[model samples]
Target: MPSMKNSSFYPSYFLLVGIPGLEHEHIWISIPFCITYAFALFGNLMVMFVILVSPRLHQPMFIFLSMLAGNDGLLCTSFTPKILSVFWFNDRAISFTGCLLQMFFIHSFTSIESGFLLSMAYDRYIAIYNPLRYSSIITSRLILRLVIVFLVRAVVLVGPCLILIKRFPAFKTNIIRHSYCEHMAVVKLADADTHVNSILGLLVAFTILGVDLLLILLSYTMIFNAVFRLPSARLKTFNTCTPHICVFLSFYGMALFSFLSHRYGKKIPPSIHIIFSDIYLLVPPMLNPLIYGIKTSLIREEMGKILWKH
Candidate 1:
C-alpha cells in the first residue's frame, strides 16, 4: 500500500473540462444536452410510473423494462448535472472525493444497465421459446434476486479500483480532460505506476461487459432459432424483440465506439472523442424509453390514458 501520510499523494480537487477545444461553444452545446437530459428523465420516469401503477404490466418483460428505466435515470443523473453545471455556470471544480463517488456511481450504473439488458434478453428468450414456463421461471422474487446480484457485482468490482486509485503516490495533474470522472481518465493522470489499476480495470470491463454481451447474444440466437420454427408467431416474436434489439444496439454500439476511440484512436481529434464520450452516456438514456414507449403497445396505451386524463 502507498503512504497515505504523504500530503502530496492525494489531490484535493480536480478540474473537469466540459468539452476540450470547444470552450467557447459550451453554452450552445448545453442546449441539446439539457433537452436530452430532460427527455431521459421524463421518459424513464413515465415508464416506471406506467409499470408501477398498471397491474397489467407486472409481467417479467415489463418488470425488466422498469428496471432498465430506473437504471437509465440513475445513469443519466450520475454525471449530466455536473456536466451541465460546467457548461452553464463554468463550474468545473470537483472535489477528489466527489469525483470518486461520481465515478463509482456512473460505472456501477453502467454495469447494472448492461446486466439488465442481459436479463431482458433472457426474458425475451423465455417468453418466445418457452412461453409456458416463462411466468414460473421469471417471478418477482427472481427479479429481485437478479437485481441484488447485479448491484452487488458492480459494487464489488468497482470498489477495488477506487482502493487502487487511492494507493497511488500522486497524480501528475488535477485536470481531467473529459467532462466526467471516468476510471481510465482519472487513472491516466496518476504519476505512479498504474499497471495494476489499468489491468484490473480492463479485467473488470471484460468480465462484466464482455460476459453480459456474450450471454445476450447467445440468448438472442436461441430466440431467433425458436422464432424461425414458428411460422404463425414468427412476426409477432420479431416485433416483440425489436425494441430490445434497438436499445441493446444503441447502448452497446455507442459504448464500443467510445471505448475503442479512447484506447486506440490516438489520431482522432480531442473534440471528436469528447463529443462521442458525452453521446455514449446521453444517447442510451434518452432513446431507450422513447423506443420502448413508441414500440411497446402497453406503454403507449398507458401514456395515452395519462395524457387524456391530464
Candidate 2:
C-alpha cells in the first residue's frame, strides 16, 4: 500500500494481470474465452444482419432485439480483444488514455444495455396488455428516441466518473489486478481520496440499474396479471416471454453475482473474482443471441433460411 503523493511523475501505462493467481493456466483458460468470443461475435452479427434484411422482423420487438445485438457486439468488442491479448500474448501494458477509453465504453455500454432491457420489457408489457395500441405506443420512431435517450443518459452519467478519475493526477500503482480496465479497479489504484468516485459509481449503479430492474419487474408483473385474466392468452403470453426471460435472467444474474463478489467477497480467491468478472462481461454477449436464436421461432427460422440458402 503506497501513495503517489511523493511520486514526481504519473504513470503513463497500466498493466493488466489476466488472472492474478492463475497465470500458469492462461492458455487453457483462454481456450473457452476465445471460443465464447468467437461465438458471441458471430452470433450477434448474424442477429443484426438477419434482422436488417428480413422484412418479417420489422416490428418493435425485433427492432429492439437488433439494437441489443449491436450493443452486445460492441460491448464484447470493447474488452475481449484486449483480454485475449493478455492471455495469449502477455500484452498487458495498456496506456493510461487507452485504459480510460476502455473503462468509459464498458460502463457506458453496460448502462445502455440496462436501459435497453427496460425498453424491451416495456415493449412486452404493451404487446401483452394493450395489444390493440401496441403498434402505436411502441413505434419505430419511439424506439429511436428511446435509444438516443438511453445513450445520452449513459454518457452523461459516466462522464463525471471519468472526470473524477482524471482529477486524480497520480497513482500508487499501475498494475490492475483484473483483466480489464473497470472503473472501480482503476479508481482503487489512485493515490488521492476516491470517496467521490466511489460514491458516484454506486450512485450511478443504483439509480440506473436499480431503477431499470424495478421497472422491468413491474412491467412483467402487469403483463402476468393481464395474461392470467384471460386464460386463453396465458400460453401465448408465456411463449412470447420465454426468450426474453431467459436473456434477462442470464444477463442480470451474472451481473449481480459479479458485483456482489467484487464488493464484498474480499476473502475469496483472486482467480475466482477475475473469472466471474470476465464471465459477467463475456457471457451475456455470447449467450444472448444464441438464446434468442433457439427460443424465438422467427429468428430461428430466419437463421435456418440463411443456412439453407448458403
Candidate 3:
C-alpha cells in the first residue's frame, strides 16, 4: 500500500477534486463567488441594520426576516472561505476535526433557516387568516419562544449526530473531494461501513428539510385558500407572499436538486454536480435578502432610510 504521506498519486479519483467533485479546477469561478459573497454579506447586513435600527421594522414579520438574514450571513461565512481557498490556492486539505465542525455548523444553520421559513409562513398565515388575532397569536413572548425552539432543534439534533459520526475510526484516506467539508464527503472517506451514518444523516435531513418543507407548503396552502376567499384582498395578499414564494421555491428547489444529485447523480458529469451543489448553498444566501428586502416596499423604504441616515 502506498504511504499516506505520498498518497497524492491517486489523481484519477480527483475527478471531483473536492466534495461534489468537479471535472476541472475552475479557479476563475472565485470571481463570481466573490461577487456573490460580497452581495450576500452586504445585503444581509443591511437587512439586519434596517430591522434593528428602525423601530418600524420591529414587528413579527421583520423580526423573523432579521433572523433569516442572520442565518444566511452565518451560513455563507461558514463555508465560503474554505471554498475560496480550494479554488484559489488548491488548499483542498481539511483536518478531521475541522471537517466535523464544518458539517455541524452547516447542518445547524440549514435547520435554523428551515425553521425561520416555517415561522415566516405561520406569520403570513396568521396575518391573512386571522388578521385581528395575528398580533396576539404571534406575540413577542411567543416569538422568543419559537426562536428558542428553532435554535434548540438545530443545535441539539446536529451536535449529538456529529458526535456519533466522530466515533468512527479514521483508517482510510482523509482527503475530501469537494470545495468545502460536507457531511457525506467526510463519510465517503471512512474505511468502516458508514451505512448507519448515512441512514441517520438522511433521517435528520428529512426531519429538518423535508418535514419542514411539507409544513411550510401546508401553511401556504392555507394562506392561499384564505386569500382566495377574500375577493378584493387577493392581490394585496399575493403581493405580500411574492417574496416568500420566490424564496421558498429557490431554497427548496435547489435543495432537492442537491440532495437527489448527491444520492443518485454519481453517473452524471461531476461538473454539473459541483455547480448544482454550489447553487444549493450559494444562490439562496445571495438572493434571500434581495427577495425579502428589495421586493417589499416597507423593507426597501426602511433600508433606504437607514442608508440615508448612515
Candidate 4:
C-alpha cells in the first residue's frame, strides 16, 4: 500500500496534481487553459449583457440563452481557478471540507446546466410554435420558478454524494490525479469498498444527461415536425435552431466524453482522461456563447453595440 499523508482515518487535505503524466508540460498547458478560461468568462458575460440590454432579445429564447450562459459561467468558475492555480503555482492542497464543497458545486452546476438546456429546448418549442400565445403566458415568475426548481433538484441529487463519501473511514492516499475534486477521483482514493460511491455518481450523471438528452430530443422532434409542416417557416426555423442544436451537441458531447472516459476507458491513458476532463469543464462555457454569437444575429448586433458603447 502507498504511504498516506494525513494523520488519522480522515485526511485533512487532498493534493491535486494538474494532470497525470503531463506534469512537465504544466507551464505550456496553463497557457491554453488560461486563455480558454478568460474567453469563457468574457463570452458568458457578453451573452448576459447582450440579452439584458437588448430589447429585441427579450424573448424566451434569448432569456433562456442568457440563463444558460450564466449557469455556464458558474459551472466553469466553480472549478477552473483551482486548476489554474495547481498548474501555475503548484498550490494543489485542498482541505477535506473544501474538496466536498467543490464536488458538490461542480456536480450541482452540471445538473443545472442539463436542466437549462432542456429548458432552452422547451423555450424554442414555445417561441417557434406558439409565440403569440406565450407572449402573455411566459412570465418572469415562471422563469424564476424554473431556475429554482432545477437548483433544488440539483442540490437534492448531488448533495447526498458528499454525505455518503463522508462516511468513508480511510483512504489509501491523500493524492488525487485530477486538478479538481471530482467525486469519482476522490472516491477512488478510499481504501474501502467504494461501489456505492461509484454507483451513485454514475447514476446521477446518467440520470441527468440521459434523461435531459431524451427530453431535448423529444422537444426537438415536436419542434421539427411543426416547423416542417410550414413551407416558408422551414428555413427560418432551421436558422434559428442552428445555434441551439450546435450548443446541445457540444455541451452533451463533451459531457458524455468526460463521463464515459472516466468510467469505461480504463485502457486509455490517464493524461488523456485528465485533458479531456479539463476540456469538458472549459469547452462548453467557452464555446457555447461563441456558438450563439455566431449563429444568432440579434446577439451579435447587440454585442457589437455594447462594445462600441464601451
Candidate 5:
C-alpha cells in the first residue's frame, strides 16, 4: 500500500498464518491449546479470587501472586484468542490499529510481569533474610510504589516501539507469517530500514528480561545465604522458596530457550519455535497457581476451604 502523504499506510488488516504447516491439523492442535488456555485463563482467575477472599493470605507475596496472575491474564489474552481464531475459524483479519494494540498489550504486560516477578523475589528475600522486618519493608505502600514504577517503565519502553511502527511509510507485506504482531515480525514487514526499531527492540528486551533475570539470581543468592545459616529447621525454610524457584525456572527457562531459538537456532524447526513461544506464554500462567497451591501451605489450606469446605 502507498503511504498517505504525511502518515504511514497501514493496511486495512493483516493475515496471520497460525502454525505454518499445521493448517489442516488445527483441530488436533486446538486441543492442547484449548486445555492450556483453559488452565491459564481459569487457574489465574481462581488464584486471584482465592487471594482476594482469604484474609489470612493478605501479605506481600500473595499480593504479588494476584498481580502476576492479572498480568498473565493480560499477556496471554493479548494474542491467544486471535491465534485460536486464525486456526479455528480462519478469522485472521486483524485491523492495523488492533494489531498495534495487541502488540502493545503483549509486550507491555510481559515486561510488567517480569517486574512483578522481580518484586516477588524481593518479597521472598525479605520474608526469609529479615523476617523481623518483613512486614515493615514489604508494606502496601511499597507494593503500590513498585507497581507504579513497573507500569511507567513498561509504557515508556514499549510505547516508542509502537510509535515507530506507525512511522513506517509502507509495508513489504500485509501478511504476518506468525500469529501475533510480534515486534520484530511487524517491523520486518516495513518497507523502510527499521534497524533502529530492531536495535531498540533488542535493547529493550535485554533491559527487561536480562536485568530481571540477573537481579532475581542475586536475590536468590542472598536468600540461599540466609537460608543455610539457620541453626536448624533448614529443610522447611528451604522448601518455602521452592515454589518461587519453580515458577522462575518455568518462565525464564522457556523464555531463554525460545528467545535464543528464534534468534540463533536457524537449524531448528519452525514448528519448534512456534510451539515453544506458545508454551512459555500459556504454560507459566497455568503452572503458577498449581505450583503455589501445592507448595504454599497457607494458600493450599485456604484454597481447600474455598473448594471443599462446604
Candidate 6:
C-alpha cells in the first residue's frame, strides 16, 4: 500500500515485485519460458486443429481432448506474458486490480482443466465398464452439456474467491517472488491480515484438487475392477489410456511436490522451490496434449493424415 517515489526499484516495481534490498534477477528466467511458450502454443494448436478437422476423431475422448486443448491454450496465454514481463522487463509489481484479474482467470482455466480431466476419466470408466453402451451414453448432447457444466462450475467457484481476494486493501510488500499471479503469491503480498483469504484458498484447493482427485481415483477403481474381468481385449482397451495416466501422474504428482515444498520444505533453496513450483504449474499444460496425441492411435493417424493432406 505504501509507495516509494523515485527509488531505484521504481521501474522494476511496476513490472515485478521488488524487495527493499535484494536485486531481482529476471533476465535469466525469460529465455526458457519463451521457448516453452512457443512449443506449448504449437502443440495445443495442433491438437485443436486435428480435432476440428478430423471427423473420425469426433468421439467423447477427442471431444474432451479439444476441451483440454482449449484450457491449455488459455492457461499458457494467461500466465506467460506477465511471467515474461516480470523477467524481461525487470518488473514484478502488478496493479491491485490487474493482479486480481490475473488470479481469477488463472483459477478459471485451472478449475476447468480439473473438471475436464474428471469428465475424461468418467468417459473412460463408462467406455471400459460397459462397452456395449459407450456410443449411446456419450452422445454429442451429453458432451455439450458436460462442457457447459465445466465452464459454469469453474465460473461459479472462482467468482466468489476472486471477490474475496479483491476486497483486501494492498498493504504489505508488492514484490511477488514467482513469475505470474498465483493465488498464494498475490495473497502473500497483502498488507492486511490474510486469514480469510488463506482459508478460502484452502477450500478452493480442496474442492478442485481433492474432489477431482477423488473422482478420478474412483473412476479408475471402477475401471480396474471391470478391466480385470475382461479378456485380452481389455488390455488393448486399457492401452488407450496410457497417455492420460501419464498426464495424471505427472500433473498431480508435481502439484503435490510443489505444494509440499512451498508449505513445508522451508529448508530448501528458494530457487529450487521456485523451479519445482513452476514445473508443477507449467509442464503439464504443455505436455498433456502431446502425450494424448502420441498415445491415441486415432489422433496420431489423424494428425498424420492432416499433415499429409496439408
**Which candidate has the highest TM-score of all?**
2
- TM-score of each model, paired residue for residue: 0.95, 0.96, 0.91, 0.94, 0.95, 0.90
Better of 1 and 6 by lDDT: 1
Candidate that scores best on lDDT: 1
The model with the greater TM-score, 2 or 6, is 2
Name the regions of candidate 6 deviating beyond 4 angstroms.
1-15, 18-25
Please list the residue runs of candidate 5 whose C-alpha ends up more than 4 Å from where it truly belongs after superposition: 1-9
Residue-pair clash count for candidate 4: 0
**Residue-wise C-alpha lDDT for candidate 6, range 21-118, written one tens digit per residue:** 22355565567778888778889899999999889987788888888987888887877887776667655567767766777888888788888888
What would the TM-score be for candidate 4 when compared with the true structure? 0.94
Number of clashing pairs, model 6? Answer: 10
lDDT of 6 at 267: 96
In candidate 4, what are the lDDT values of residues 1-115, reduced to their tens digit?
Answer: 2436555467888889879888989989999989999999999998998899899999877888988999899989999899988888888888899999999998888899999
lDDT of 2 by residue, 248-307 (tens): 888888988988998899999988988998899899999999889989999889878988
Clashes of 1: 0
Structure candidate 2, residue pairs in collision:
none
Expressed as tens digits, the lDDT of each residue in 167-206 for candidate 5 is: 8889877877677888888898888999899899999999
lDDT of each: 0.90, 0.89, 0.79, 0.87, 0.87, 0.77
Candidate 1: where are CA atoms >4 Å away?
A: 1-9
Query: Which one wins by lDDT: 3 or 5?
Result: 5
Residue pairs with backbone atoms closer than 3 Å in model 5 (clashes)? none
lDDT score of residue 33 within candidate 3: 84
Give the residue spans of candidate 2 off by over 4 A.
1-8
User: Which candidate would rank higher by TM-score, 1 or 6?
Assistant: 1
> Where is model 3 more than 4 Å wrong at Cα?
1-16, 19-24
